[model samples]
Target: MTEHRPHSATTAMGNRHDYLPAAGRDALLPTYDLLTRTLGVPRVHQRLIDQADLRDDHKILEVGCGTGNLTIMARRSRPAAEVTGADPDPRALSRAERKAHGLPGIRFDRAYGQELPYGDGEFDRALSSLMLHHLDDDVKAPMAAEILRVLRPGGRLHLVDVGGPMTPADGPAARLTLRGHHVAGNLGDNIPRLLREAGFDCTEVATQRHRAMGRVTYYRATRPD
Candidate 1:
């Protein structure tokens, strides 16, 4: 169930600078790992799996599967499930493939969120963990559309990212911090809105706080059957 494929150029529309620069991203892998560990990434991913009810034949897709940490978790928790990890960074995908060696039902692809390389209605579930904050402002809706396009009717979508509903008092402060990071910061309850606009029905929007990443939202949505 594992396959490796080449990527195209246009797929990287907005996320051409996932972490500022390509070299910086490759160099920060270890640091990012450390940060995740300190921020209780395992518990976060476990919550993600708990939110998803995987079946014997569920085919799972992990968007922005950096180093495949969440991807590995999903595969291990549901060994029978078919799991495919997609990312635009070949360096990250390379590490993901290396980490998933000998693991059946887990694969990696060099693709972007706005341009997934799969057929329509090919997956039962799709998950994005702590990666949406890296996307550029304009790519949000397009990425959601691609997710919806590749999912079958009634397929589920799960997203975990840094940002959520903001209060009137939070408007200015949030926008300032977001501008500094070159990320939209979502400053609003944006993920669910984007998914809803892309034809998915959002069922839940939960929040958690991290010492370093601030407020993070967990979105659970489903395609209309």
Candidate 2:
């Protein structure tokens, strides 16, 4: 079994603004796409996409789509599926929209993960990548519930985020990198339990370690049919 580690931190009470400065934000827009494409980190997202067994007719929703990298990938992977990417950052949404321009059947919206602006059971699959760590339990727990709420009865939720290695001591820098984000520094520990509490059965938990900086953890859960 994978070891779980929890860290303590103060949760943000209300909607928080992006920490990146304007210039930094602008720079990140293009850099994000380049890095994800070059390093194949987005493959983590791809794994989730593949696990969902997304069909051309499936309606998919991506929460916290950084810059449409995964959104575009999903659209291309499932040409017949209607894909929508939502983010709380307006700048990120703009970048996503620009990246997706001229792409039919794909759209981007400005929204929060904790409070998605969509109807219940509206999508066949709901996904999030590298976004949950930015949220606290106050946000993440509810966000998981919201993801389950928006997914169809038999739909699945795929989450990709930073987590510990097979053991906490296996990777030290991962904890530091997460601390740098000032979000859920070490919250991956609660994911499974949280999913259970949110009314979903976590079907799988997979992990991939990066040199020393961090490891990626992916969770696939399903709403009861």
RMSD of each: 4.5, 6.9
Instruction: Summing lDDT over every window of 10 consecutive residues in candidate 2, give the lowest-scoring window.
Output: 1-10
lDDT (10s digit) by residue, model 1, range 65-183: 87888989999988899999988777777877898999999998877788788999999999998777656666767788889988999999988776775333345544454554533
Best by lDDT: 1
Q: Which stretches of candidate 1 lie over 4 Å from their true place?
A: 1-24, 166-185
Cα shift from native, residue 26, model 2 (Å): 5.5
Error of 1 at 61 (Å): 0.1
lDDT of 2 by residue, 96-122 (tens): 788788889998876666677888999
Model 2 scores a C-alpha lDDT of 0.71
Clashes of 2: 0
Report the error of model 2 at residue 138, Å.
1.3
- Indicate the residue-level lDDT of 103 in model 1: 95
